[model samples]
Structures are given as structure tokens and as C-alpha cells.
Target: MRAALALLLLVAAGTAGAQMYKWKDAKGLTHYSDTPPPASARQAEVKNFNSAPGADLPALLAEVARSHPVVLYTAADCAACAEGRALLQARGIPYSEKTVSTADDHAVLKKAGSPGQLPLLLVGQNKQIGFETATWDGLLSSAGYPASSALPPGYRHPPVGSAAPRRPSAAERERQAQEAARAAAEEAARGKRPPPPANAPPDFQF
Candidate 1:
């Protein structure tokens, strides 16, 4: 038992030292490999297996996630969306959720080629329009996720966010307002003529 335990420790140490590279190609598809990314790769990142919290994820699961990241598009008060989310949770699939509850979110959904469908699932470049258990399972399987839960204990999916770009923060809004005010002040200082009065005749000049 002592010998076996030591051997396991040695293996774990070796695995922890392994390096992984993650990057996006020109087409914006993400890739992961043990080798350095090619010259064309963008947003390249290097990770040591055990360098950070939750970085000790199982080898196969980590590789699969990097190669085929999963995204779920959902809307509030939708039964199908709830079911879909439940399925992913039950399977312990790490994924990002995008809530589609606004016009901007709907536009993003349309851009993704959905005809306003709820509970859209995207596994890498492939997409599924609705929540069908078998279909979703099949897509996940094809993307290399395990048949059963393999998630590490205490692992949690990222917090859900809007499908559209997030609204500017208060500070950002303030900065923008100040810039606009400054521009207006500069224009006024330049004596730029104001528009003619709305009540004036069409032939009236400023």
C-alpha cells in the first residue's frame, strides 16, 4: 500500500507539471494543445495543470471542455429552458448560460441563426434549437463530454449573463456624459449657429 501510494503521488506530480496552450484561430474557434500555439493563434494563453484553484480538473474532461466549450441560451419563465438547464446540470457539464430576455438578446439569438427559439444549445460550432433529451445528449456525446457526471466536487458553472453586451457601468456612463458635455461646450465656444426655430417658415434662415 505504501509503494502504491508513492507511485500515485509521483504520477500526480508529473501530470501537474504538464503545460497546456489555449488559443483562438482566425475563425474565432478555440483550440487547446500541449504544444505552443501557431503564429496565427490569437488570445493565446498558457496554463500549468495545477497552478490555480480548480486547475486540477481531470485530464480528459479539461481537454474536452477546452476543445468544445458549451453555451446555453435561455429565457426566463420558459419551461423548456428550465428542462434544458436541468439536463446539463444533472450531467455535470460545465457551461456558460446566456439569458435572452431583451431585444438585444433576441438580436443576438437571430444572429446565431435561430428563428427566435428558446433554449438554444451551442456545443462549439454545432447548435441545437430546442430541448430534446436524446438530441442534446447526442450533441454532447459528439462533443466528447462524458456519459455520466465527472465534475470535481464543489465545481460550479459560471454565473449566467446577458446574451447582449452588458450595459455600461455607472462610472462609464458618467465618463461618457462628461465627454459629451465637453464636446457640446466646445461647439458652443466655437459659435456654431443653432438650428432655425421649428416654428419658422421653410424659407427662414438661421
Candidate 2:
């Protein structure tokens, strides 16, 4: 009976979605079964990863994305940023990146809740300042991302950073537009608009 039970457990371990318990008998023989071990035996749980709910994966990932959107703030020529980017790509995590290359970029990074740290990671409101692989992995796993990558082939992330996109609010947009128009009008009134150079397009207004 012991030999038969051990063989059965081995078979069960190969199958998807199989739940089994492992323990050693009084004789020190290892055994596994779908039922609980006897009180005298030591118990351990064995999980099968292959049978994890495939149908629910999409919904699970979507919920995580909604509740914890991943954002990475990086900069060019930074070794840490490069490593962090590679880690995210390897994990097939979908994330948005903000590159801090200019004054405007620095302002945007600050507004995103960092103390001007490069390679900062933001999961929803949770801030991780600096690139640490183990910490990043732990947080992402806790947030319910799959252990293996789920990205499809040929997936390309969009380009990073727009010169000061987050810094300009609607009011700022209107204010800047008004200022530009005022400057243009004043120049026109003073007839100070410089004449286009030779071969310049007629539509050119300086």
C-alpha cells in the first residue's frame, strides 16, 4: 500500500491543479496523498503552478493595473536606470517611464513624488526611490503580477518623456497662450517683427 501510494503521489505531482500533502511515515518512508496526513506524520503542502487559473489571469492583471499603475522615472546614461529597465522588461511588466534629462524633466519627476532620485519607481501612490531589484520584485509580486512574463511578441513601449507635460495644468496652458498672443500683438504694433531672410517662406512670422 505504501509503494502504491508513493507512485500515485508522483503521478499527481505531474498533473496540473493537483493538490497533495507530503509526509514521512513512522518507518521514515516519505509519502504523499490528496488527504491529510495522520497526526503522527509531518505535513507539507505542495502546489502545482501549471494549473493556476488561466481564465482569471486577464481580470487579475487588469485589476492590479488599475489599482497600482507602474511608473518608472529614469534618466539617460544612468547604469541603475538601465538595469531597472531591463528588469521590468524581463518581467513583462507594463510601465510608463519619465526621463529626467532637462530642468522641465526634473520638475516633472519632483511632482511625481520623488526627491529627485533617478530610477524611482511608483506603483500607484507607493513610492520606491532608487533601483533595487529584490525590493522591486517583492512589491510587484505582492501587487499580484504573474511570476512569469505575460507580454506578447513584438510588444513595444511608447517613447518616454514630453518636455514638461505634467507641469502644465489647464490654467498654465491658458496663461502661456495668453502671454504668447500678447507678445505677438505687441511686436506687431511696434512693427518689430523681423523680416524673413532671403528664401524664407512667405508664411514665416517672427
For this target, which candidate reaches the highest lDDT against the unseen true structure? 1
lDDT of 2 by residue, 1-206 (tens): 33345445546644334224566888888986433345577434332222333422255665575456567888889999999989988997766666787887787678777768788887655778888999999888887777778754544453464425444579976875676666656656667556788898878766
Per-prediction CA RMSD (Å): 20.5, 26.9
Quick one: best TM-score, which candidate?
1
Where model 2 places Cα greater than 4 Å from the true spot, the runs are 1-57, 166-206
Clashing pairs in 1: none
lDDT tens per residue, model 1, 13-131: 54354444679999999986543455578877655453346635588987777666677889999999999999999998877778898899999888765789889998766789989
Evaluated against the true structure, the overall lDDT of model 2 is 0.65
Candidate 1 lands at a TM-score of 0.60
lDDT of 1 at 27: 99
Q: Backbone clashes in each candidate structure, one number apiece?
A: 0, 0
Least accurate 10 contiguous residues by lDDT in model 2: 47-56
